[model samples]
Target chain A: MARVARGDRAAFAEVFRHFAPRVKAYLVKSGAVPALAEDCMQDVMATVWRKAAQFDPARASLAAWIFTIARNRRIDLLRRERRPEAEDLAWGPQAAPEAAEALALQQDAARLARALSDLPEAQRQVIVQAYFGDLSHAQIAARTGLPLGTIKSRTKLALDRLRHAMGRE
Target chain B: MTPRPAPRHHPDAALLMAHAAGTLPEAFSLVVATHVSLCDTCRVELAAHEETGGALLEMMAEGGSGRHEAAMDQDGVLEKVLERAQALPEAAPPAPPAPGTDLPEPLAAYVGGGMDAIPWRRVGGGIRQAVLETGPDASARLLYIPGGRAVPDHGHRGLELTLVLSGAFSDSEDRFGPGDLELATPELEHTPVAEPGAPCICLAATDAPLRFTGLLPRLAQRLMGI
Candidate 1:
């Protein structure tokens, strides 16, 4: 990311190679046609390169940050509206996150991946649909046999665990 | 940064997750963005949700859950993206918001400035409002109430999020001060009255039009577009 921010095409190309396919898959799952997804995927990668300076590893992982960009682009294309973003918290020089903290966050991310895969197939499917499929909570409940309360509790439990892992709880 | 008390109420986990996933409607997103701007606790929670999204994206990539590999021409797409990138200048860092603005950045962008800049229209009683332009899926508005004045009792058909930007308001539930968010679902109906102090200013978003119980308020709702 630092290299990309410095306008290194090599670094940007490496990121594109790794994430382009995944972003395409996400768009497809969200109901974009393959051709549309491919076009949008290109736009998303271009954005990743252009917005590299805004990427803060302390606040989000590269994959997470890219996910947000792709998500925002999808909303613009599909919904025809810009999604409102939260105000940027002012980060002073003295407030730079510790190297150890960033490392811990990455490790927790790995744990979260493992935890997600370990979830029951039904639970995981609903979660995947919620994010990539663009289904609302109510829609997810209605589509699946699971009750609304069950779906909410399942996601809530995952969020609680993530908060604990992030050391925010 | 001035230290304000953390918000006592927040959007539920589902709403935060939707926002992180970028699936929330524009009106709801506005409320969430403005609330998260003021509340660090919800900011951390939102980050957690985004992290979850990151993990899911990684998992999908590793698992190759879709047929994208068969259909996508990776090298061809990369060439196109590189071409586009060459023409595009890198984005500059966002400038800091003007000092002493009463509204958060997202809301301020919608309002064009702070409290003084709002083009409030009278919505009857001592309350005024300015409906913000969002997508058809939902609506967002800024509301101003004189100190101790009461907004009409209303119920929501869908979700309604009220975020206090300045001063305070009290409903049947509790007092909502600056940065505090109150989420009203269809099941709850209450009248919110501004607390005695400065006039209360709030940014409110509702997925469905509010259902006012009073006959006169219902007529006002038609004319006022509330």
Candidate 2:
């Protein structure tokens, strides 16, 4: 953060190297078209560069802050793109075909892999379906026949548990 | 000093865990921000989650080539971005920010709906409240009350999301500054007081009325406890 605050372009690039692909992959899984996801990724990095001095180590880890930025960008694009309701269902289940590109997310990859692998079948299913499969809580509820809120709550619990377990206590 | 225990209404380990894992919904994300505004335990836990996220990303890169059979430019992006940053004009003059605010760009984009200008309804004594419609759905709306003013002690049967946009508030855990996300489940109970010096302002969303728990709380719930 200090380096970034000092206008360290190299430092900013390192941050991008760490998070951009993962953020992009995340957007793709969340229903963004591959191109749009890439665009958001770039925007998030730009924001990171512009706001690096604002990064508070006492309050936020870099990843959390970056991901929050990515999440916000995702939301902004979703708001701006003006997709049809017919495309909503189409959005889910459309994973990025660039499996080769999924290879780009280099930060924290192994821990997440182990965590994803170790997840209980049900939890894993819910999370994969929700994040990567592009399904919403309501959509997951419909597909799985669970109540909408129940699916949401349970999915949330599963993701948290997996992240915690993989990250350790 | 020893850090305080988290507030009762603050989200538990599970919710932060999911948020770190990137599985929580946008609607739910708002509520989680509210509790995190006041809860450090979850915040630290979130750091742990990020560490894990970093580790996970690294491991996948080295060990999971099976997913990518074709030649690819995943590394190319890293090089490209680095080159671009390296080429940026060095040490340009920094721009001065606007006044009375320290919001991030995204929050700045959302700084409207005239929260400061909205008409607040007095749902109960000493409590000012107002609800506005938003895009996420019927459930996606902005609800606000001046912070530090004790709201009626209440719990929700459904998910409730809060994000502190301005001022500050505190419960059992910690004081929440701007940009904090708080999530409350059906089981959690919350009552927050405004921090000294300013009226606490937050953006909140919920689908159901707050269910006042217990007799005293039930009676005082109208006063709006957080």
Candidate 3:
């Protein structure tokens, strides 16, 4: 990312080669059509190239930062296609994480991945739908035929379990 | 010695997850991001969510299709990126906040100059507000209430996020100090009074203009452009 920030074409190409397919695949899994995912992937990679200077390693890891860009761009694309009337799709100013927390988080990435798989099936389902499927609480409830309150509690409990699991590490 | 109490108010898990997933609306995301910046606990939680998102991406990469096409168009993608990068503004990121202001880096950039430079307009009842240009459907503002001042009782037409930056305030919910976020929906209405001892400063956003209860504030709402 730093090299891309310095206008290194080679680094930028390398990044696109590495992340484009993964980002598109992620978008497709999140409900975007293959063509739309590819289109959004192109936009996301372009944004990564343009906003490289704004990427703060102290706040987020390279994978996390690129994932955020991809996720947000795909969401914007989907929202615009679905409801163009109210979707502003403007980039908002985001805050930075403290240095210590950022380091701890990066260090614990593997533990976090493991902990997620350890969550109960019900808890994991709601969380996956919320984060990866981009479903709102109500939407998740409707899709799963669960009550809204149940969905909320499941999500909260899933996060608590994650927190405990990560803290134990 | 024990550490200070954690922030009493926070964005819920769904909101935080939505934020990390980058699916939150622009205005709601602003408040969440600002609060996450200031609150270490939320920052860590956000990181975990981001990591989870990254893991999901990896899972998709292993199982989902389109790798062959991605390889084929990698050069085209890089060219488009290069063209886009050339058109980006050459301006640098905003400088860090100067000493003493409670505004976070993101809010400071939005407000431009320093806190003192904020263009506050009186909205009556000893409360002052400086509306910011967040977007058309939603509005962001900085509210300064003198110690003990009270905002009119109100409910939301959509969603309202009020994040305290300094001092404290209380409504029907609870006491809110710095870094506390009070999320009011259409179902809840309460008059928020600034806690005594110091003035209360908040960065607030609303999807729709507040539904002020008192006839006077309601009558003046148009004049105040709230």
Candidate 4:
């Protein structure tokens, strides 16, 4: 990300190679046709390059940050509506994150990924459908039979780990 | 200035998840965004959901290359994106909010300025509202209730989200101060009265029209488009 922010085309190309296919797949699962998904995926990558400088590893992982970009682009292209984003918090004197904090966040992200893959099939399916934009909160509640609180608690365990790593607690 | 107290009430995990997934209706999204701007607790929760989304995206990538081969023209897309990147200028950082503005940035953009700039219309009972333009899925409004006055009793047909921005209000549930969010489902019914002191200001959103119980308020609802 630092290299990409410095306008390194090679770094940008490497990032594109890794994330482009994944973002395209996400769009397809969300109900976009192939051609539209391709177009939208390209737009998302361009935004990644443009906003590289704004990426803060302390706040979010690279994949997580990219997910937000792709999510916003999907809204623009697929839904054709404006998304209201929360105000950016002022981090006060620390313009750049501490190196140790960034490393800890990355490790926490890896653990979260493992935990997600290990979830029971039914639970994982519920999460996938919800994040893929195939289900709304109401539909998820109605279809899963599992109460929303149960799902929240499952995810909250991982979130608590992340919060501790980020020193929020 | 003394920092505002942290919000006690917040939107549940389901709402935060929908917001992170980009599936929330625009009106509801506005309320979530405005509330999250003021509440760090909710912001962290939102980040957690976004992290989950990232993990899901990664898992999809690992599923197989078969889907990727069918959907994307990789070299062609990369070439186009790179071409665009070459011509793109550096993205400028977003401008800081104006000093002394009370509304959150997202809500401020919709209002076109600060609270004083809203074109409020009287909706009866010492209450005023400015309905914001959003998608057909839901409606959002800025509401002002004079101190010590009670908003008409009402129930929701669908979901109703009320986020307090200034002062406080109390209903059958509890007192809600600045940054607090009150979620009302169809089963809940109550009359909210602003506490004495400052007038209560809130950003409220509803998926369906509010069901006012009183005949007079129902009449006013139709006339005022509440």
| Residue-by-residue lDDT tens digits, candidate 4, B50-155 | 9888888888853434655644656666778988866767678766666777688889988988888898998887789999988778899999999999888999
Model 1, B126-177: lDDT tens per residue?
Answer: 7889989899988999989999998888898999999998899999999999
How is the predicted docking of candidate 4 categorized under the CAPRI scheme?
Answer: medium
| Top TM-score prediction, candidate number | 1
Please list the C-alpha lDDT of all candidates, in the order they appear.
0.84, 0.56, 0.75, 0.84
Q: Which prediction has the highest DockQ against the true structure?
A: 1
* Tens digit of per-residue lDDT, candidate 1, span A70-154: 9999999988997899988876556656788788777877777777777777667767888998888788888787788888888
Q: In model 2, how large is the Cα lDDT of residue A141? A: 86
- DockQ, every prediction: 0.68, 0.11, 0.29, 0.59
Model 1 stretches astray by more than 4 angstroms? A94-97, A145-147, A161-169, B61-72
lDDT by residue for model 4 (A14-117), tens: 89988988898899888899789878888889989888988989989999999999999898888877899998886656656888989987887787788787
Q: What is the lDDT of candidate 3?
A: 0.75
For model 2, the local distance difference test gives: 0.56
> How much DockQ does model 3 earn?
0.29
**Which whole-number lDDT from 0 to 100 does residue A38 have in model 1?**
78
lDDT of 2 by residue, A1-81 (tens): 679878776776677666776777666766788778766777667677766776655434466567656655665676542
Tell how far residue A151 is off in model 2, in angstroms: 5.4
Off by over 4 Å in 4: A140-169, B62-73, B87-89
How far does residue A119 in candidate 3 sit from its true spot (Å)? 3.5
